[model samples]
Target: MNDADLVDNLTALESLLQVTFHDRTLLRRAITHHSCCPDTAVHDSYDTLEFLGDAIISAHVVEYIYRTHPDASEGEMTAVKSEVVSRRVLAQVGQQLGLFPFICVDIANLRTFNERSRDSLCADVLEAIVGAIHIDQGTEVAREFVTRTVFPMIELVSTHAIDTNPKGRLQKVVLQRTGHLPRYRVLEQSGRHNDRVFLVGVFEQEQLIATGKASSIKEAGRLAAREALQLLQKKDKRSSADDTTA
Candidate 1:
């Protein structure tokens, strides 16, 4: 878009964000991908802004989790915090704001913008916008923006929370991948029944995927499931990389 059109679009984005843009240039830069504008070194894209946004959002999220869930265990708080700040979830949040249509990337890079990576682009721009807000309005305004915009996303994500039942998630993933369910077996038990340590192995058909040790069979199973999830995530990344190379 020309500068005039870009300014007009920025005005609309400012309206959407409910923030008055004291400097529209930052917002313009935030929406731009390095491929689109290779004017500056390294930061012509929103990479630096995205980095700043990551830290700012993290700090506010930490405070928000601590204050809002005061009675929650450290594990519980960490689970929620991790999910809220995750790239996937952040992309979902950006999608909810209808940002995909507004993002600016090099025309040449348009071929790479599939539904999956488009969401990633949205996430990056969302963080860049947060960074821009911090620079323009200061920390308090940035905190307020995140608190207002991001807090509701917590509920949206919690409704579909995966950490609540890693075993169930693992089973579903395994079933989809292999058309077979995973089986869990207790490898060993130690100590008294009340204070026992259980070793568990999770297997897909006859092939073992991972093992875990916990205070109970159920907890051990969950730990195994969590490990399986990580393994699956790594596998997915590898698959995606292969596809890109192909």
Candidate 2:
């Protein structure tokens, strides 16, 4: 977009964010992509702001989880925090607010914006905006902004909040059963590089106990481990019942 169009878009974005900037330049830089910036030598892009925003978002999320869930375990709070501040969730929030259209990326870069890349861009921009708010308004306003935008995401994870470290739990189970740790192997992979899906199997010795599918291998492996853990626990209960009857 041209300068006038960009200015108008920024004005609309300010309304969306519900905070007008004292230094409008900060907001502009926050939405700027490095590819669009002429001076490569000068850091006039969103990278630093994104970093600052990440910290700000994390702090607020951790604090919120701590205060709200006093009876929750540390691991439970961490899982909730991880879900709240995750890139995927942040991108979803940005998408909900229609933030991607305001990003100042080059036309060339725009062509490469697939769904996965667009999500990544949205996530980065969300953080940069938070960073900009922190700098322009102050911590109190930034905290309020995060609380308003991000606190609601807790519902997305709350219903499914189990142990996030499923792999660690699976390892202990495998060690107890067979005196060897479980291993994961990719059973299937498909789709493009930026959005590939993986089907992973969790094995105990030569037996493939369970499998899980997801976009990332690490997540897929964790899922497989969770499934395997559940399967093993059920078998153990069955065995105890059989022994009692015998």
Model 1 scores what on Cα lDDT? Answer: 0.82
TM-score (all chains, Cα) for each model: 0.63, 0.63
Model 2, 28-55: lDDT tens digits are 9999888788686147899899999999
Question: How do the residues 61-167 of candidate 1 rate in per-residue lDDT, one tens digit apiece?
Answer: 88877755433457766788898999988898899888877788776756665788888899999999999999999998898889887888765553345467777
Provide the lowest-lDDT 10-residue window in model 1.
154-163
Using lDDT as the measure, the top candidate is 2
Displacement of the residue 128 alpha carbon in candidate 1, Å: 0.6
> Please, what is the whole-model Cα lDDT of each candidate in the order they appear?
0.82, 0.84
Off by over 4 Å in 2: 107-111, 162-246
